[model samples]
Target: MIRTGNEYREGLKDGREIWMDGEKVTDVTTHPAFKPIVDVRARMYDMQHDPAYKERMTYRDNNKTNPVLYKLPHEQKDWADKLEAVDAVMNDIGGVVTRVGDETIGEMWSLCDGRDVLASIDDRFSDNIDRHIQAVTDNDIFHVSANTDPKGDRSLSPRDRDPDMMVHVTRETDAGIVIRGAKFETAAAYADQAFLKPTVGAWADEELSDYAVGCIVKMGAPGVKHICRSGFAGKSRAADYPLSNKFDEVEALVVFDDVLIPWEDVFFYRHTKAAQYVRSSLHRYSAFPYVLRLLYVADMMIGTALWNARQTGLDKLQAVREKIADLVCYREGINAHLTASIAAAQRSPGGLLMPHQSMLYAGRVFAVSQLQNMMHIARELCGGQICITPNADSFEADGSGEWLNKFYSLNQRWQADDRRKLLAFARDLLNSDYAGHRLTFVQFAQAPHFSHLAAVYQSFDFEGPLDFVRKSAGLSDQVKG
Candidate 1:
């Protein structure tokens, strides 16, 4: 069922333990640091009820309206519809905000595709996976992913150093199992739940390990503590840091102090193969949304650069045009990969439509690895004015206002106020502290660079190339065999 913005906001006031900047946050919906982002998420929910957006944002099943984002992909139109829904939200919000729900709900879908692997360990575990997937869609829950645990040491095992370094099953109770550890999760403080699982590690050889566990964690459950990093909002004027003030999705070190996971919530436990399968294929479907966000980022860069060039008449220069072309190539390169992936979409073992794995992963690597250089090019095109420009306050100050206006005013169209606003936006987008954090988020948020490349290597088919080379070299049939 589709929920309103106020209902989603009220859901977070469930007395969940949340801490930020060394103080407990009483209400995430009202907290200054979280309120802006929370409002953005709330607005997304409310849009589903708006007549203009209701058709695109929701679908009717059994005469009950449900969020389109939560629906499982079984066909090609399912994917296209999801893409449209996401675009509507982004356009409505006027900026990018990841982790709202759709970008993360696919992690469960990935596990659902691994039902066979899970069933091998326990048939009941496979049943749990299906039930949970249906539960999220049916309930319209806001779900996020939890994969990275704060490992104390790389060389030492959890037993040698600290058992809490990695999340493990502390004890099995009749109702469920208790867990203790911490995970670095984005939006955990405001999200309703997280699909907690193991980080990337070797687990194939072991028959059983406490570290091999996966389950659905309720964010408001007892012993779930959310210690969030200091937020960028409320730290500066909104005029100076528009994106940072409105779009920052807070990350938290979520501590699970003997939290209980009921039997129905546990998908897999004490099974190394299940853990390995999840770690390997976690991003099979989610990568589509993850990489698609970059396309908007690329457009932001292009728009900023092109506008700056137009303001100064640099668009007339051949050299300037060449750099603009470079930015376009970066933007379209991502576009091509996403488009081709959908065109060549493959059916999963679980009967769900998944983007072509090779193209999707290759797109992720290309978009993430080349982001910094693209940002640099945009920065150069924007020129040093973005950094040297004074704040909006200075432009309005009595003593300095007139002098600043005399200098900043460019032409009949470019006034001092507009110029200052543009510079401030460009600064926050490319040079501010928020800008740096966003770059790091793009790099490591999904996984490290090597992991993206590894996915590409694993998904690509090698036999076609091998066979073609063998035939070209006139090799015998015996060699082929």
Candidate 2:
């Protein structure tokens, strides 16, 4: 069932312990650090109810209204519906949001794909994934993800190091598995629950490990503490930092202090093979939306850079136009991959329509790997004025306003106010603290660069090239052995 904005906000008031800047945050719905993004998420819920957007954002299924993004991808249209739903949300909210339901929903499908393998370990584990996936559509839950741990020593195994460095099961009670440890997660403070699991495929040689556990951890559960990093919302005026003040998704180092996970919530526990399977195929469907978000980020750069060039009449210059063209090509490269991935969609193991694997993963590498260089190109196009522009306060001050007006004013059409506003927006988008944090999140938040290449390697069908070269060389049948 779909929920209203007020209903979603009410859910966050279950007394989850959230801390930021050495103080407790009583209400994430109102806290300056968390409220902005929380409102954005809430607005998305509200949009699903609005008549204008209900058609695009949700659909009727089984005689019940469910959010379009949560529906499992049984056909190619499912993926297309999801893409349009995400676009609708971003357009309504005025920015790109990664962790809110769309990007993370497909993760459970990873578990779905591994159903038979997990059933080999425990039948209940497979059932748990199915039940949880349904519950998401039924209850309209806002789920996040948790995987990375605080790695103290890269060389030491979990047993050789401080046990708390990795999230692991401590004990199994009649109630469920009790977990202890910490994880670095984004949006943990505001979301309803997280699919907590291991970070990677390497589980060492251990057949059974306490660290190889996956389950649903409620954000409001007892003993679950959210210690958040400093957020960018309240530090500066919105006029100077528009994106940060309104759409900052706060991250937290979530600590699980003997948190009890219900049996139905546990996907797998103490099975290294299960953990390996989960990690290896974790991003199969999820990565499509993750890479898709960059299309918006790329658009922001192109729109900002082109507007700056247009306002100043630099579009006439060949070099300036070429730089704009470069940004366009970058944007379109991402578009082409997403388009092809869909056009050449493949049927996954679970019978869902997954985007073409090689295209999707390769597209991820292209978008993430080239982000900084593209940022620099945008920064260059914006000129040095972005960094040197006076704060909004100076533009509003009586004495400085006159001087700023004279210098910043470009023409009758592009007056000082409009020019100053554009410069401020460009500064926030390309050079501010928010910009740098976003760049880092884009590169490392999901997985690192090498891991992207690994996915491409693992998903590619290399036999075609191998067979071609073999047939051409004429000695391959004997030599291949």
Candidate 3:
């Protein structure tokens, strides 16, 4: 059931309502803003079919070849396989893409691990999650997640103001539950289905609130509309913003105007305990791939800085070497965390292998929190030339071409055209508008920084440190409570 790139593109032509730049988009696959990233996604699907990558990208299950990324993890090799598969993809695509199925698929896997709690609320809910997980593998659906809602007037309670501020069930039909509100999700416009859930909050406070619901939302469903943010692509010249044009994954504010979620698709409904359980364990398995994306980001930074240093002959300077070392440290820091997390992988409640929680969550915190500083260090190493350089047009123009060539050609080997391309690449990576947006994107990709710290707190065993201190200080059982 592996899909081809063209098949994946055809799936986006199902009359989904998508708006960008104040106009309705007729075809997401052809639209300039979405197509590049969509093509990236489609390329990933096609890679699974290519013979050279077929072995690396897929595995045989029940006499069918399934995507390696979507397979349920059973042991450490499963994680290793995922790592290798993703590595193959990153190398193939030449960039990092966060929401292209693999990263978000694990969110449902998190719910898979929480089936007991879901079954306590409704046995059908647990069964739904298991089926959806398999469906993504069998059908090769491009799945994403919806968690955060556009909570307006947070000072007032949901009932006090507009209840629609949070996505809530407005009414129930024999067919399904009708939902109304909006969620801020990336890649929702081009994705096949989203595993929608309640936003993170005090789920313990309300037992049967309409807001406590989880379900599968088809992207092309009748009342679903995608009002997307203006993309990083199409606005800038491709040469000036290469990554922006090629790798910008457009995010959208998906409006659910009385959208229907069929009965079989609903995971939980009016169940606060289920919501609470899911909120706590939501990113358990997904955080690995999410954080793993940043490791690649770190490599990009290191690669950019190292190349810039070598091109400018700054590598010989002691200060320049120290800065490059700093970038290397950041890259290796992310790598070490990922490698160790896999090495110390744990088993989830539902018999899935999960990266060690402490290491994975801690790695997420370190990677996300330090991303901006690392970018700045890279910017400094690439030198002020990244900003002061003229556009590609100037280098290729008549009079300026001669002048730029004279100044830019540093040696017989390092010429004007190569230098311009390097600067443009570095600018787009570390200094362009796209660069800033990507930095912000990584900061809040899975959740927020506060949520990351909370995960670290919850996952880390405080008792172990407490035991050590208690034994060292001879402080006793009285303080244990």
TM-score of each: 0.98, 0.99, 0.98
Worst 10 residues of 3 by lDDT: 198-207
Cα lDDT of model 1 by residue, 299-354, tens digit = 88898888888878788999988988999999999999999999999999899999
Q: Listing every candidate in turn, what is its Cα RMSD in Å to the true structure after a full C-alpha superposition?
A: 1.1, 1.0, 1.1
- Estimate the TM-score for candidate 3: 0.98
Give the range of the ten consecutive residues with the poorest summed lDDT in model 1.
472-481
- Compose the digit string of candidate 2's lDDT tens values, residues 175-266: 99999999999999999999998877587688899999989999999999999999999899988888989878888999999999999999
List residue ranges in candidate 2 displaced over 4 A.
478-481
Candidates' lDDT values, in order?
A: 0.91, 0.91, 0.89
Residues 401-430 of candidate 3: C-alpha lDDT, one tens digit per residue: 899999998898889888888888889999
How many backbone clashes are present in model 1? 0
Residue 224 miss distance in model 3 (angstroms): 0.3
Q: Which 10-residue window in model 2 sums to the lowest lDDT? A: 472-481
